[model samples]
Target: MAGRESLPLRRLKLFQPLNRLTDDQLILLASRAERRTHSPGQKVVERGVRDGMDYFLVAGTVELKAGDGRTSKIEAGGEKALTAVARLQPRMYDVVAVASCDFLVVEQDILNQMLRDAPLIQADLDSMVDETSGGTDEHRLLMEFYAELRSNQVSLPSVPDVAWKVRRTADRENSTAEEVASAITADPSIAAKLVRACNSPLYRGFNDVRNVREAVIRLGTRTTRQLVTVFAMREVFSTKQPFLQKSIDALWKHSREVAALSWVLADRATRIDPDEALLAGLLHDIGAVPVLVHAEHYARLFADANLLDHALGELKSDVGAAILEAWSFPATFVEVARHAEDWQYECRQDLPQLVDVVQVAQLHAMIAAQQNADLPQFEDVPAYRRLGGLELNASRSLQMLTEARARVDEVHRLLAIH
Candidate 1:
């Protein structure tokens, strides 16, 4: 086996967290990192040992053996390989090469320092990079997009007039259901959808509501306003371009799932408003809407799914916050949009907030879809512990969701209505 003095920067881009590093930072890390290879049956790492280096498998397969005699194999280029092997400070497993293997060894302190400096490094790069010239197509497009967004040149979706009117009417000190219903009736489609929602399985009563006014009474002013906004939000996800339609459809589907899960979690786990949680879940990714809409003008972006996903990952939070602010939504909702994907985010308040509920719900949705490769340990998520500390482990949480599937499905179906 051969060894290299310096790891390739491009190779660093393939791993999580490190993938987030700026090019210059990655180059600096690559120079300090070591690339080593081991033959089959060689020990890569020993259990219960505190090694300050992180081992990333670049090629071939490795096996991890715990003290309990349990073992798992991780192959290079697999989903699990995207992260370091047994990442804890004191190694929890004995790692051995199953075949000839390549691994990049990075000093823990150096890597952590670089990660901490990434934001500052990125800020400096942003100020210096010629957005018009150099860099990949994705980088150039992102720069242009950010420039437009900062200048308010990008178009943001507007909250429907009916939704705004209903919210305003509902917020009145002495407002009646009739007043809120009146505002909702301005948009006949949303009015009809509200009526249908109230009669749906989740909210169904012995007698069906015959009109918007009656629906408003049964669902209450707060719920009526929330439902109106939910119905109106469906329109914001539409696209005229055929190429972007699939992405829009997928986004809508994911939003609905998160919304349903958020509603259930808020109702069962915390005292937070279920309707508000549902709305937060739906709007969490609302920032991506304008990004896709803007991408319609860039043929190359939409054609390359990877580049499009990268753009969404990088820009969605900022765009979402802007959209929520423009819609005059609550600061809480704005916070949800901005930090929904931040697994490390935690509310400083004594109890969980809407953002916490939505974060747990989003992770549950990801778990249900078998997309947990890069996900942090369920117990490690601050939002999850805040919602149900120790009492709710991964298995129990999954069971809770299983029991609530019918309700989640009903909410999903209700929101899916045009």
Candidate 2:
């Protein structure tokens, strides 16, 4: 069985690039890769299906026929042995095994995780993805989407009115805590949740806070602004479209967890404001809202989750950055949204930025969700190392998050009031 599992790695020369991986990372990655045998004259993949899996022929010959009738054969261990699919999603070609074949298949997300952990592999894959995307229709679509957004041809989401008022009021040089409280209290539902949040284990002070003013005072103006903004942002996530409801719900759940974890990490590790991290985490996936909205109008995208996810991966950051910019969010918050998924991204100085806090928090959230089976260890993720200062075992990290459950729960409850 072990030999069977390793066959794909051995036959395709993937073993060499994979040498950059540490033993633990490699084990995690290899475990997730699937090895298969294909009989002669069998189709490996069909054209026009949206798939993000990378496939490499390990043994025997494979025929590739493009949609335009161009054809080529990739022999086992040929010069192109190391290549996977040239274009990831909405496959442009039909691939078939020319003889009994061994094939290695890796999921796109897993490959991304490997690249994130192995910088050398990341560098190579970066070049590969860019080169492959050249002249592709998907590339053209992404560019056109970006151009439309930049030209305001597509309407971007607006910040909730309450979030806007709270943000603008808090931005004033002379803004007082009481004024911040007034802005929050205008929305009675949000005001009640803010009070409840102030009393939660995360922010509870000398006594139970009963009123919005007192809650704002206890949490302070900056945190109040962040809390208000996050509370208000929840309204924008709702959709009347049935197909996107599940995805939107998942997005919010993920966001809330990231926001809670970001607050904890920022409070513990860095000099940056915990509230800033909180807001950053809450809005990290805000770009998906627009994509789902567009998908609603163009119903075809609803039929394929892979295609939708790929589209989100391609456009979310730019769209998110644009939305935040439209809302006049702080430069740090806007930057956090723009680069939420960029784990290798570094800040100007040694101190971790809000972006780092959000990234680390997002990683922790993923770990908790058990969606990180193939991801790098906490120690290997660049954001965790930069923000955490030391590697933490899974147990230690889980303990920290567990201990903060009350606070995290409180944040979730507060946000869910809408």
- RMSD of every candidate to native, in Å, equals 18.6, 18.4
Q: What is the lDDT of residue 178 in candidate 1?
A: 80
Instruction: Give the distance in Å from residue 12's predicted Cα in candidate 2 to where it truly belongs.
Output: 37
1-418 per-residue lDDT for model 1 (tens digits) = 5355666677788885577678998888888888889899999889988878888888999987767555677799864576676665467688999999998888877776665455422543443333423445545555555445433457788788888788878877899888888888889899889989988988899999999999988999988888899989988998888878988999998999999999998877788889889999999999999898888877753465755666677778867876775565776887798789899998667878999889999998887788788899878889888877636667887888899999898888889776
Stretches of candidate 1 exceeding 4 Å from the true structure: 1-139
Q: Best-fitting candidate, measured by lDDT?
A: 1
Question: Backbone clashes in each candidate structure, one number apiece?
Answer: 0, 0
lDDT score for residue 228 of model 2:
82
Which candidate leads in TM-score? 1
Misplaced by over 4 Å in model 2 are: 1-151, 390-396
**For candidate 1, what is the TM-score?**
0.67
**How well does each candidate superpose onto the true structure, as a TM-score?**
0.67, 0.62
Candidate 2 residue lDDT tens string, 85-148: 3333466578888888787776766655554444322343334435544434433443344333
